[model samples]
Target: MAPKDVMTNCHAKSILNAMNALRKSSTLCDVTLRVEQKDFAAHRIVLAACSDYFCAMFTSELSEKDKPYVDIQGLTASTMEILLDFVYTETVHVTVENVQELLPAACLLQLKGVKQACCEFLESQLDPSNCLGIRDFAETHNCVDLMQAAEVFSQKHFPEVVQHEEFILLNREEVEKLIKCDEIQVDSEEPVFEAVINWVKHSKKEREDSLPELLQYVRMPLLTPRYITDVIDTE
Candidate 1:
């Protein structure tokens, strides 16, 4: 008889589900990941399959490769659990309360998908009051798209944004960066000037010296003659 070839229908989820069950039972687990005083048992192969971090750690001659237990720093135990769930199920849970912490942890694990999802969630939550804070957060985390989106939103809502505490807390360079942008949406130069003054006076002793520098960016030519003589002169 001629050689016969056969194929069987199978789904990938079955394998993951089986692995998840084994993980829960602590069966065939090769390592225990310790985080924040909690120990999580898992299979190195499964972790290697999901995270570049684990893959490199297990494959390289690093001290952790042959260790029976490894300590995971810079992450809370809950975050570690969430990441493990994602590795085993290809799913994750994100919420407003957790995203700020989760995104950094995901980045450390080199889980780009999780980091992107967290960034999108933050972007969706942006508003006039919070856009500045979000932009700063995105910048600190190197989430380029989120930072750009937040910047555009901040400009679109500049009038309302200056009223928030986040704007007042911005350092000199950050304030200069915002006011110097020609794209800042303001009906007149009045608001821009007011924003600069407010930011400077928030810590007058420390920031007062920068007032003249920031004022230079506010276009005086755009102000009306009456207001300039009245409001502008009084300042």
Candidate 2:
């Protein structure tokens, strides 16, 4: 054979490191992505390779295809920098401080790996105080697994969760949905009933009408006979 092909195991990583170096030095970068009035120099090819959002913009007939500078609105500069770090280095730091912002940015960029990382971080950070909020956030972002995890965490700590302001602020529908779930862990039906009353009393003017409807799910049969004769009858 006149020639034989050779492949280097470190070739990919070596190229990435070199590209990162060039990007930091502003060498041979073909595009500038501006976010929140901050400029980030990068190669269109590199960005396209990592994110489908960038790929579509660069390959399509849109006006941005040939534009040397593109402004990405609704994205913070810090979030953009974190995303660029992930694209160039194949790694990212997903922390509580940045995750809320980073996950949305990653979602917009079509970076599934980064989004999954953010979801995992949120899942790990779930607690009685924040589980309800995290559950809503996960649902809003379509992170099904994280949402389920947060839901379970909320129900597992239902007694404590009811003490948080997030629980008190829930609208009628959300309150009803949680109390109806069989998965909620409570010492007894007393806590369940109390949770419902507490949520309603938080905004009585707007929520009092729904109390009668929510009370129907309190599972009267599950309540102790003494509670019915004493607490339930009085309330």
Candidate 3:
């Protein structure tokens, strides 16, 4: 049998034994194992191996009404099966959730095709709304290329998203932390401050007449002492 098949068989046997132990034991254990199985064969292998334990675990402790709580169904089974295959054979078909997990695995396995697929999938799936999560995931995985792509995409398309007063102000608190962090480089441009100033100026220009209060705020002597000094010296 192929190495993947061997691994799958081994994992299935392990799962079965764990289930049998649960069935034979009188006491309920606090442990819960979550599996994502993708293929029917993989599900069958798991079910056949651990049916006794699963049956007991489901039937004894939980009521019929609560069966859904333990019952394996839908995408969960398929995902688990795929994961099993990947763990064993170092290859498996792709899916969205699996793609997220597979990228790191591909990198570990040095599987060029799988790694490229993961990158492509991420690039295609990413949007202004999902960019933050993608950025975080890429960063966590140390996928430098993917992280750069995500950052560039966000900076271009989602600039306004992060430019909100709330985000800018909140993130500013960590400017020092970010600067000190060896991993990330802080830009000297101060995009947040510049964005805010530009927004205020644009709003003022759009108004039928710039609000007197706003004008007064911007024109306040203390607001631009350097500019005021420059003008006075020039005069």
Q: Which pairs clash inside model 1?
A: none
**Inter-residue clash pairs, candidate 3:** 36-79, 36-80, 37-77, 37-78, 37-79, 37-80, 37-81, 38-78, 38-79, 38-81
Off by over 4 Å in 3: 1-77, 83-93, 104-112, 163-235
Each model's number of backbone clashes?
A: 0, 0, 10
Please write out the lDDT profile of model 2 over residues 42-153, one tens digit for every residue: 9999999999999999999988999999999878999999999999998999987899999989889998889999998898899889999999998888899999999999
Instruction: List, residue by residue over 73-156, the lDDT tens digit for candidate 3.
Output: 333544444544543344557777678666665554344556666777787887756765676778886777787887676665
Ranked by TM-score, the better of candidates 1 and 3 is: 1
Return whichever of 2 and 3 wins on lDDT: 2
lDDT of 1: 0.88
Best by TM-score: 2
Residue 212 local lDDT, model 1:
68
Q: Considering TM-score, which of the candidate structures 1 and 2 is the better prediction for this target? A: 2
* Deviation from native of the Cα of residue 214 in model 3, angstroms: 22
